[model samples]
Target chain A: MNTTGSTGLRPILERHESTLLANWITAQKAAPTYRPDLIKENELRDQCRDFLRALMQAVQSGSQNVDGSEWQPVRDLLASISRSRGKQGFSTTATATFIFSLKEPLFQLLQQEYANDPKVLAEQTWATSVLLDRLGLYVTEVYQQTRDSLIQRQQEEMLELSTPVVKLWEGVLALPLIGTLDSARSQTIMENLLQKIVESGSETAIIDITGVPTMDTLTAQHLLKTVAAARLMGADCIISGIRPQIAQTIVHLGVDLSGVTTKASMADAFILALKRTGFAITRPTAGR
Target chain B: MERIPIIRMSKFLLVSIQVDMHDRLALALQEDLTAKINETNARGVLIDISSLELVDSFIGRIIGTIASMARVLDAETVVVGMQPAVAITLVELGMSLPGVRTALTVERGMQILERAIGPTVTEGTDAGPEE
Candidate 1:
């Protein structure tokens, strides 16, 4: 090995000397089959490492080329690194380090190879940015789709819970409603109850809500709307199963249920419906 | 007009009012119906108002209160036989009849009661009378 460093190459090697030594050792071990003359190999390795270190520093510091001599060292290094890694049984880490060490010099080579083509540079940048943006957008879209599906499932569950069962009593229709009432659920309840009232041709509809946990203004309003819709179909709506808490909430909220008929419980609502239809429930005589 | 006698069905009482009845008469019918419902220990009371041409807010409030009162007594009240136009008008005016069960016709109201009684009672009755 030449103990005297080239005057112009000394600074470049000093800055990246350790990294260059590691890369050179890796390259030698990777290509154990190659039997290049010892003197030539040593000279080529030192020259290549010095050239690459200088090229990287120049590129990072935005320095101008140091005459046409720069191309010679880069070309030789590329040929050697590519040759060594191409051989069988090259360790991946050694090959990767050698390749990465040549990045700055390779870029310089590419710039010279396409020197007259501004369009190539523009296209390369555009393609890189576009690929990056598209990858980001794909990730975002997948997240949103997952969130939307979860919400849809929740809404479906609410609809199922809000299903109103229409029970026929002597021609009157009683819709027994159980479950908590949210805005979405209440809307579904109204739509279903109204549809049943119209389809069944029933004159009375009793809506029992004893199972509801609590009532808010929105729930109360939804109930009113259901009653109105039922009545519009020429069916009277009776609301039953009001818990004391719910009633107090309605009263405290100052919500006027003045025109809405109410039953205390499901049974009461049904009996009222029976009476309206002229079905008299008489006890069986002691002796037939 | 023939007076429709108040009758009890299952746990409910029914008072059928004539169509085109005066508002005062309807109000009186509601009161009388409620009183009868309370006396019979009926679970519910239905006032057949199919004949009324108009349903105002006052009547609605009274009906609502009666329903509420019946609820306190462990009974319910329903207003039956309301016309479509009347129903629409009341809703348009933001009026809700509180304590009453309103039905399109009296018969439908009865069916509503039967269903409310559930399979246990309905099934018991569904069995043919014993020989």
Candidate 2:
């Protein structure tokens, strides 16, 4: 208010907050992204009001940068709204319309206030457009960040869920691995298996690769590395679940698993592991 | 000029490496270990590497060389108590240490020796089978 060149957008918004909000809502509701199923009318009104109040405070401070401290509350509010809207299956365009719609009402007020001064009107209109564009882009950016984090978290969970080390007997542990054995997943598998072996003090570990999709050269190396590590830890490793195709792959690839024990099925591996651990399993001759 | 100590425990010479060995020291120790095997006419060798925290390819080859050398000299060699990190590094470095027998502890190594070479041959040794 002290400067003549100042836009005075703050006072104008404060005076006609309801009228501007009504107009903004009409613009949003008429758009193709108008989703009554996802967001209720009352909730939209509350968000509009909160954003208006924060923007008024921010503009009053005479700071041009959106990154300034005065705009923090507005940013926080929009980030939350963007994340929730993204989660609710709102399109990026729909979420952005929430910020862009306010420009209509805002431009009208600025035009009416600066009617006589063409220079002031043009300047205020350009400033409002720039500010609104930044805010709209911020919403989409926050939405994408939220989506990315959710995806990363799910990948980690999948890694942990896939590699589960189970105790087969008193001193024997078995790791039935599924899916492709990449470097990251191999690390998870190794760490989990090693920790389980230490905790159980198991002398024998059987790795069943039945669920593994294919046997590439890299995957074969990872398997051999796991076997060598387990041997170094004083636990001999046996690999099972060698399908005919996989067996052919290993032989065709000329992978040297010479000293290590491998079997065609989990049962064969289990029988061998039990015998090595000095356990005798007798089959029931008669059915109960 | 510090040297790694090689102690004779009955028929098996025990070398517990408690310090990080540089290239020269490791080569020197390899030479000393093979010499001790000949001097004592030991039947088995046990090298405990639990205290060894890091091992490059050079040190890995040395350990492999010593094991094969002992085997050629009519003695069995067992590397015991290798830390997990060192083992992983060795594998990743593409040195599998073939023909090297590994055990979790020195006690396990001794048991493996007795089982492999028979207790009868180790008749009067102080550290053989019994207490």
Candidate 3:
């Protein structure tokens, strides 16, 4: 209702809807973000048409701000586009460019329509630029949130897949670790090892850290905690795959590992465990 | 009127705790186990705690105390059949129950006791089939 110097874009957009859409599609196709492999040309045109229609409806409500309740449909449309583009492997800039690319075609149209009035032209062009910038920023924010959640999900999956308990022999269990040992990961590893120990009723467990890259004080403490827990369950834990560097690190950190049994390789630990469990491994005669 | 039973084997006393142990129950079991060890001159004590799904710091300490008591009475204590969750909890509580021997099951615990008691005592039992 506040029509003072309004120069609302809805009338111009409605009058030349076909021309605006044709020019906007051309502009989008020319932009660097346009991907032919991920999206078909028809799908891209449909998205552009939907976006223009939503923008016209929003502008008819007389609020240039994208955050206004009148722009809810437009916001929803951009949010969906951002999410899909993110899933399609579009970079943040590519997703945001979907909105920014409309600037050229609309600005050209605005110049042609308001050429007779320079003052009105300046105001309308500035308003249109600000509006488009806000929309572009909104799309970028949604895309970022989608990417963050995707990363979070991948991290959770990695944590689940990292620790695997393998039963090497009848009474011997091997847990091969493959990543940095954080507190959360340590908790999972401890629980998984303990559960396998109980289920198998194994007297010996070999924790192979060959795939683990670093050894810090906290990681050392977590390892000790896991060993202690396994011991408490009537199972012995043999920390194998101690690279020479890790051995030096452990000693320099002053972690008292004398109470724990450490082996240079899983084979040595397995042999020791077999010996303790009262089993002997002997090679048969060659010609017998 | 509630008491944990202590069964006498050949040279070992079996204490199978199948219920959620409270404070009084744990204390009573400790006293009863020590008295039984002293009375029977038992060589080993096998405690089956596989049924215990939960354990606090107090219960963990009680287990330690029981083992110490049995040791003082000339009986080696073997805690057996501990659930995985209970073991993790005990370790988290920082009470790994040091000086206590542990076995995965009651049969293994009995074997440990049989081995600890030497061949002289087990030679006679070896004549018959073990259940």
Candidate 4:
């Protein structure tokens, strides 16, 4: 160990790797960032041990500058750990603490190794803190990116799942729209409903908005666009589940519905659709 | 390019638009359709656009003009089989095509045309003689 000006962490880490790992894990569990409920002791211990090995390897390359290619292995290791924790629903702070927890144990080893030289101890500690901070930030960046992509994928899946087009009858189709009708979701709904209309050869489409929470101007325009598209495709669109409050809002907003047919419920719209298609439903009581 | 052929079926003119009509071709069809309506004395016109993938505002206006001209010539016009995407684009472009009638298919368009012209106009149907 070159103790004069060489402050690489390789010597201390190699000498007491197991002890330092155990201390680091103990300190980690004691911190609020650690969640034992999401992971087992053996798993966390394995990650910490692997991380220490990579850190020691990087330091052994004899490079004090963390930005150099020698420290790339350590960065790669931290990034992979952060990605795993990101998928496990770990918060950014918790994931960063995984790298930061090694600080205390490393500082302790440095203090003991350089007890006679306070200036070298302070210098080494400061360098370790700056390097650890950089590594912590890298982990957070990777974790945030993973989380954002995960959220966007889930949102797309939900949008596709929320809007479903059903074939009500031979000449009739139904679209049940649930949740807020943003422009993107509205585009999805329009495409889905129109595709169903074409496939089923249905002349009438009933749009059920019972699951929709509110009626805004944009949503109403989206509905009109869908209706108009259906009409152009040789299909008539009937909007159903217009609650009293929504009716008041539509009237207040002055959205035109002169060419559109609105019904209080899906059943009424279905009956009207059946009538338009020249089908009369007769319930025979004696047969039952 | 060949002009769109107008095939007369019973008392109606069937214009199955199998090609993507440019502005000139559409106008030529419009002129030919009205001229054929006057010569044949057709009661209805069924414009089948199932094969057409696009419809801009100019094409949309031509369709509307044809329908209005057919109405003035004492004929009903039903445009059928418009693709859903084309319809959405037309509506988005602020042309709902209020002047024309639409049906899901040519057969259904004939049914609507028969209904509009009255059931008696439908020749050789199951109910044409009975009703």
Best by DockQ, which number? 4
Model 3: lDDT of residue A53: 88
Candidate 1, CAPRI quality class derived from DockQ:
incorrect
Which residue segments of model 4 deviate by more than 4 Å? Answer: A1-7, A36-43, A61-77, A115-127, A286-288, B119-131
How many residue pairs clash per model? 42, 0, 0, 0
Error of 1 at A146 (Å): 3.6
Could you give the CAPRI-style class of model 3? Answer: medium
lDDT of 1 by residue, A1-288 (tens): 111112223343455556556655455545544334422566547655664564454334432232245434443444454444434233443333443433343334334444687676444334333422432333334344445666788879868866855667646776667777776776667667666665667667888888778788978887887777576445667899998888899999998899788877888878888997778676798546
Query: Can you tell me the DockQ of model 3?
Result: 0.66
How many pairs in model 2 have backbone atoms within 3 A of each other, for residues 3 or more apart or on separate chains, i.e. clashes? 0
On residues B1-131, what C-alpha lDDT tens digit does candidate 2 reach at each position? 88999998777888999999799999999899999999999889999998998999999999999999999988898888877788888888988787888877777788888777774543564454443
Candidate 3 per-residue lDDT over residues B12-108, each given as its tens digit? 7889998899999999998898889989988899999999999999999999999988888888889998888898898888988889899988888
Candidate order (DockQ): 4, 3, 2, 1
lDDT string for model 3 (A1-288, tens) is 234223557667888888988998888788887788998899989999898888887777777556879889999999999999999999998898898988898888888888998887888888888888989999999999999999999999999899899998889999999989999999999999999898999999999999989999999989988988888778899999999999999999999999899999999999998998888887788546
DockQ of 4: 0.78
Q: What C-alpha lDDT, on a 0 to 100 scale, does residue A235 get in candidate 3? A: 88
Q: Write the per-residue lDDT of candidate 4 for residues A102-210, one digit (tens) a residue.
A: 8998899899988998888888888788778888888999999999999999998999799889988888899888899999999988999888888888889999999
